[model samples]
Target: MVRYSVLASGSTGNAILIQTDTTSILVDAGLSGKQIEKAMHEIGVSADCLDGIVITHEHQDHVKGAGILSRRYKIPVFCNQKTWDGMEHIVGEIKTGYQEIFCTGDRMEIGNLALESFAISHDAKDPVGYCVFAGNTKISVATDMGYVNAKMKQRIIDSDALIIEANHDVEMLRIGPYPWHLKQRILSDHGHLSNETAAEILTEVITANTQCVHLAHLSAENNMPVLAHMTVKTILEQEQFKVGQEFDLEITYPDKPTKLRSVRRR
Candidate 1:
């Protein structure tokens, strides 16, 4: 059994908590140390209960509070070499005693959890997503990526639970107030995922083993929870996949945290 919680998910910040019987890993720490502590307590997890913090990229929303939390709790911080370079300033500015860096694609064991990293298409230097296994169940998270490549799709296909990005709606983005260049940047290969793209990916890749699908990293100005959910739900139905009754679909907010989701593999 494994438990997963979305502390926060969006451009403002992002963090995920994955725990098994013997391991507790924090996927990212975008929130401040105090906010992270509060969210952890809401999910019935204490700071001391965490084994390590694995960062996805060097983006401010993902790395802002990581070093602070690591120094405060003395928890190990794992990230790729390039990410370390990008974050050296922010993380190094703070005095941290606990830090262990690893290259992308390396697998590491933290207590009972086995974590593997896969490259992702994002604007940041050396951005990657993660797949974690505990016993027979798998929990995968891939957000802040532009599009789902073949490799990303394959890695997430067999997971029991998936946290994927649905960043914006095409129409909203085109008409929104963001500058033309910024909009173009967001639509590029190394940008964020659109709602339609996310729907297509989920409809094509989700299987029976997938118990839940969380729509993450939504753009507040360009997307609404109702829109993202409806887009994916409609696509899944068109593909002859049952919605709600067969599997659960959740939407995470930038300001609000998601309920702690538990997975049981029989």
Candidate 2:
């Protein structure tokens, strides 16, 4: 069986736990080590047991705690070479043997999990998402993308579970307190995905194997969990899709870890 938990998500920090009986991994370690450890322990996961910390990009909110975790646990950190170059200064210093680099689109064999990287549109050095295969279960974690492209849709489809970014509500973002420049950045093609776009992506990519979908990387100031959920729900309904009957939809929060979502192997 394979299971996942959103330890934390938002602009403040982002981390997710993907685990099977034999392996345990975190997609990003954006939070401080203390915060991540507490969250993991609250959810009954031991930080010391983590096999690797896999990074999606070099953004501070995605790599803040990576160096601390790696240095403390002596766990391997896997990411693209460009990401290593961009995040090296922020993460400070990592143990020589623990820094692992792989090409953006290659299959990374880490313990019992096979992680395949796929490109995404984001304002970072070579951002990518990952599809993890654990036995018969496939779970894809793709966030921080501005828009869904043909390649992204291809990689996201036919998954057992998924974590897609629903970063902001357009109206709130437009009228919010952010400056014009920041607003423009968030709305750019290389910015985060809005609720509507996320729904549209789901409508195209969801398949028979998709059992659970997690809405992640939400904006605290520009979006609310209920609003994000309703927005996606409304769009999905318009497409004649039943939200609860067809599949389970969940929201990831900035303040706490989500309940463990386990994928039942068929």
Candidate 3:
């Protein structure tokens, strides 16, 4: 069985914990070190037990606590070369041996899990999402993306569970309090994914084998959890798919941790 939890998700911060019986991995550590430790403890895991940390990009909301976690726990941090270059100064000092680099499309092993990073359309330099394979189950983490392209769809297809972005609602963002430029940046091709777009992408990639969908990276100012859930649920239902029967849908919170979700081979 593979256990997954979104320790925190939103524009404010992002972190995900993926674990197997023998291995534990953290996808991003955007929250403070103390906050990350508390979230991990809530899920019955310790920060010291983490095997490694895989970073997606150089953005502050994703890399804020990465350095502290790496230094404190003596865990390896894996990221693309570009990401390493872009975030080295911001993340502060990481021990030489702990700073590891993996190519975007290549696979790397950490304990019992095989991790593959795939390119994502985001504003940061060489941003990517991760797909983790454990036994027969595959879990994909694909947040901080503007849109899902063919490659991204291929990467997410047949996943047992997914943690994908449902960042904002188009109408709400358009009429909200953010300045015009910020709104436009968020609506750009290299910006965050909207709730409707995420729903559309899920329709294309969701399969019978897929067991769970986690709507993540929500915007507090522009999106409500209920609205994001309803948007995706309504779309799936319109296509004659039963939500609870076909698969489970969950919304991750920005301020707290979500219950651990497990995917096991049938």
Candidate 3 residue 169 C-alpha distance from true site, Å: 0.8
Candidate 1 per-residue lDDT, tens place, 220-248, comes to 99999999999988888898888887789
What is the C-alpha lDDT profile of model 3 across 1-266, one tens digit per residue? 99989999988889999999899999999998999999999989899989999999999889899999999999999999999899888789999899999888999999999999999999999999999999879999999988889989999988999999999999999999999999999999899999999999999888988999999999999999999999999998898878999799999998899998888755
Candidate 2 structure quality by residue, lDDT tens digits, 118-224: 99999998999999998778999999988888989999898889899999999999999999999999999899999999999999988777788899999999999
* 1 or 2, greater by lDDT: 2
Model 3 residue 60 distance off true place after TM-score fit, in angstroms: 0.9
In terms of lDDT, model 2 sits at 0.92
lDDT, model 3:
0.92
Candidate 1 overall lDDT versus native: 0.87
Q: Would you list the rank order by TM-score, best first? A: 3, 2, 1
> Every model's Cα RMSD, please?
1.4, 0.9, 0.8
What are the clashing pairs of model 1? Answer: none
